[model samples]
Target: MLTSPVDDEPPLTGKMQPTNVVVLGASGSIGEASLDVLSHLPPKRWQAWGVSAHRQLGELSQRLFATGLRPRFIVASDPDSASMAQGMPWPKGSELLFGGDALVDLATHPQCDTLIAAIVGRAGLESTLAAVQAGKRVGLANKEALVVGGCLVCEARQVSGAELIPVDSEHSAIFQCIQGSSSPPRSLILTASGGPFRTSTGEQMRQASVADALAHPTWQMGRKISIDSATMMNKALEIIEARWLFDVPPSKIQVMIHPQSVIHSMVEFVDGSVLAQLSPPDMRLPVQYAITYPERLECPVSRLDTLSRYDWEMLPADPERFPALTLGFEVAAAGGTAGAVLNAANEAAVQLFLDGEIRFTEIVPACRSALENHHFEQHPTLQRLLEVDRWARAEVQRWHSGTRA
Candidate 1:
């Protein structure tokens, strides 16, 4: 659940103003984790002005009740969830915001200076874009915005000079390691957990159960992301995100299978030296880091003091073992609307796989098929990208249903 940590705290006097934050997808695991992080901030350092939840209205309301914060507004981005949350007890003087437009409105709200864009999938693109256009400091929790709308996002940042701090661990790791550096690194290395299927064979993965796929070795995540991790597609999308976030060519970004999941990511300089960011496998560290950028705040969660006890394990990403990782590199290399098509197809395929409508192994192949079949657009306008997004989703659905040519 999301939080409004500003309620109990008194104002800061000198050089310590709070960040006025708006959280999108306020009911997910990330939202829940962010609440914990926000609660620990020195009262004067953070203020959650608004929050938007797409589903789980009951849970959202319960969490909101605990905070005793009557926010400026709360958004239910889903119609049914909106109706449900409206009936739930809210703090006095609280106003309700509904639908995508409401989310956009809040993103552009003058009071909201920081945005935690966590609304998942392509659904998160518009509000994220809105935050960027409004020049809000964006702590990006949504990968789809960068994956499907990287070009649009890049253009907006160039025009508005909006700051995008990645909430994803991998990107944040790279961001931290590269700090104080004037030049770009020679290459980037993103680490993966190898997921639950890291050691499973292709036949075993093909026959893997939905429950099996969701059993991630590390990282408690929502269903879609957990499944994506199981298939290594999350890494793929992050590869694309890193390409845009860091302004690097696809060849410079590499993925390594680190089953321990200790080292978030690494950076290799032009020289022989390499730098890496180490933290306990905690999402709040990065989330807090993004919120309190340029300054690391005292977090509720402490770090592992014994650094030399555990051995670090790292291995090359086996493309044959996890084809989803390949898709990200492919999309990164291709750029343009190819990312939109690939991401849309993967979104559809993952949903279908979750619903038991498609086999576990079919998800990546389905995305590849959609990418290959789409009319390639080297340079696409936002409208063209949206058109391709819709086309790819439809094609994935038809193909999943055995209705496509």
Candidate 2:
């Protein structure tokens, strides 16, 4: 059984009482965006209480210094980066901690009102789970935490009464649309930008270089995510994430290629009503929404200009071109160690592609091979999931080596 925060504590009433936020993965794109959101939010309503950097301690320190944001605790999750942080000027009065466990410590700390779990990949799973277990309001930007262990995280959230709010633009849009009606949503429609290769031929994609794949059309994102987008694996992963986040069946969730990306997502009701959330491709909007739920504040993100005529297009996603969608739906429906395997395999395969160790087209096949070969478990513990994660990663490596040999 997990413990929760004090029930008797008074709720936030005014701007005078600030919400203390712990942003894990404080050096990543999402982290930087989150920090920007926090900075723009009224100072009395939010504070950067704690932050962590996996290996970008120097950059994190520089960002903090530049922003003049003084967090109470600064964590360097990679122990090797401790020396790099030694010379960097971190904010004054910030106690610097080192190693992965420090992330968990900051997550479950009593003062942390909201935890922004933005660490990329499986490295964030444990701390995100800890925050949920401790009943912290979690702004989950790390989809892998749920993709890898949705059952465990959901179970922890249920037990601790933790609020698992999504920071992903698509999911956040769906979340916003669902809040409008008292009726249950009939289905969720996830929109995709179709990446840089939406119009590229299969042969063209097969010959795509790292530069080609990372050239996203609308959204600016990190390399791993950029590749995932180009391959449509990011949408696939979002499919898995939406399944768990909305507690909706995979069949009820649909993906459409919206090249313009003005419509983030939509939700259909039983009455044949569809509500869509539309905005420019800005991450700060969703990040800010996750931080302040049930309340809308003035945001720094650019507003969608209604005066300009727009050409918005939504097309059916072709799973034949992007096999990763098939894998995502399969993993979501399987609901066990399958998700762990798929996430780990994709992460490994993406890294391989980035390293030029694998072809652009090999990423999905590699994930599929691992998912198909792994042992299926209907119910798995956290340790089992982690073990399966490692096994799947190794399986991808073996697949690569065997393919080259």
By TM-score, the best candidate is 2
Flag regions of model 1 displaced more than 4 Å.
1-17, 67-69, 403-405
Worst 10 residues of 1 by lDDT: 1-10
lDDT of each residue in 1-405, candidate 2, tens digit only: 112333245666665779999999889999999898888888888999889998878788878887778997888889998888777787778878888888998899777899999999888899999999999999999999999999999999999999999999999999999985888799999999999999999899999999999899998887878898999989988999999998999999999999999899999999999999998898889999999998989888899998999988989999998888888898899999999998999999999999999999999999989987988999999999999999999999999999999
lDDT value, residue 231 of candidate 2 = 91
Candidate 1 global lDDT = 0.87
User: In candidate 2, how many Å is residue 358 off?
Assistant: 0.8
lDDT of 1 by residue, 1-405 (tens): 123443345654567666778888878888877766766676566877788888887877777777554456789999877668878887776778777788888887766789999888999998999889889999998988999989889889999999999999999999999999987899999999999999988899999889999998878899999999999999999999999999999999999988887799999998867999988888888888989999986787667778467877999999988988888999999998999999999999999899888889999999999998988878888888889999999999888767333
Quantify all predictions' global Cα lDDT against the true fold: 0.87, 0.90
Residue runs of model 2 more than 4 Å from their true location after superposition = 1-15
Model 2's alpha-carbon lDDT is 0.90
